[model samples]
Target: MEGKTCCVTGHRDLPQKEINHVKAALRREIDSAVADGFTRFMSGFADGVDQYFAEIVLEKKKTNPALELIAVIPYQKRLDSLMAKGRTYEMLEACADVVVMQEKCHPSVYSHRNRYMVEHSDRVIAVYDGREKGGTVRAIRFAHQFRKELREIPVGLILDKNRTNLGQNRI
Candidate 1:
């Protein structure tokens, strides 16, 4: 599925009010990607957007078992450091493949993982709020540099439907 793979990147902490909208957007993108003949979805397994992306991909996999969820972990220690280890572990257990980018944490480990994902993926789906910084921005820049197809979920756009009480809950 080299040519059919898509990787996701997003913020680790989303605004509490926009969580539901981000999730809905992610679901829509994943469905659209699947419909377009994409089968393998890659995730960084980070807290907010990455976990949400992985969750939605797994839900899609229920109906289409051919869909594969790949975890591109930045470092071996990342799992241990995450606050939502239980949820992350569950996602890891369900993933079709997991690639630990680094055995130890370093300043560039996460960037390396992001580069790896962008390099291997034919398309990139990003949940970005138009922020000029952070890993999501770097990933998006890499996607441009590599000339990958990019579909973005506009986090900065505040829709009335997106304003809800869905606080900081994990799916």
Candidate 2:
């Protein structure tokens, strides 16, 4: 679990339709990784795609005893704010075997969190829409800088193919 580490990064908002597609892709990638003896998965546990990835990894961890989910928490206060919204955060937190809580919660907390994940991981499972200059892009870039193997679930692939939402809506 320590050596075979992968991280998840993605936008905070995404359409439900696109989410389902990403979920399927994620399941395939994660399960394949498991078969290859890659057991550790780190997630920021942010809203939308991050949470989805965490949940899926947790589910896999249930039957696969070797699988471990590590929550790279940026700040406890921000996590508390998200937890106040509902039980999803609690569920994710419960599943994580290791919670890496960062000490500082500054304006650049998320960027710092992304750096931590990228630096710690051997690979990255990125879910990006490719429509914005967002945190997801920055994290992917950082992973690239470290030469981590990236497996992307590009939401823009689906959105752009349909060309329905244009750029008005983003995930």
Candidate 3:
């Protein structure tokens, strides 16, 4: 297998079960990348799957000194709303090479950050719930538009079984 840079993207509001599944999928993808001699990883540093991927890379780096984890932050200080930002920052501080999309926060900086990750990566690993909007959807669409190889993990199983109306309810 040939080495290649792997990028990760996913939904931010994933259920706990779905989050675990997505994390497992990302670990597999990262392991595959390593088997293929790829030691570099890039993550958007979002709350859910992005954080999971970054953590996995950080763990791998402890055992494999050659592996590199890059945190492609969408904007500086855009993480204020995320409860996991502190932990993500700690992980970034430990093992990641940080790349800020903008020196300051902007409304559309995340979109630009996603584009940058897709443009620079050899492939994308995405966890989506088949939504037509949101940052995850946009990132997947960007990957498709750019003709990048995508490994998708759909998280529809996370939705409540009793809930039929998705519009008024949260997944």
Best by TM-score: 1
Candidate scoring better on lDDT of 1 and 3? 1
lDDT of 3 by residue, 1-171 (tens): 134788888887887667677778888888888887777789887777888898898888889988888878777675444325677558877754778789787778889999999988878888878778788888888899999999887677434432455755774
* Model 2 / residue 161 / CA error / Å: 4.8
- The global C-alpha lDDT for each of the candidates, from Candidate 1 onward, is 0.87, 0.80, 0.79
User: Across residues 56-135, which tens digit of lDDT does each residue of candidate 2 receive?
Assistant: 88888778767788877788776677667666656656654545466657888888889989998888988888855878
Across residues 26-102, which tens digit of lDDT does each residue of candidate 1 receive? 99888889888899999998889998999999988888899999999898778666425777778788899888888
lDDT of 3: 0.79
Look at candidate 2 and tell me the lDDT of residue 97: 56
TM-score of each: 0.87, 0.83, 0.82
The best candidate by lDDT is 1
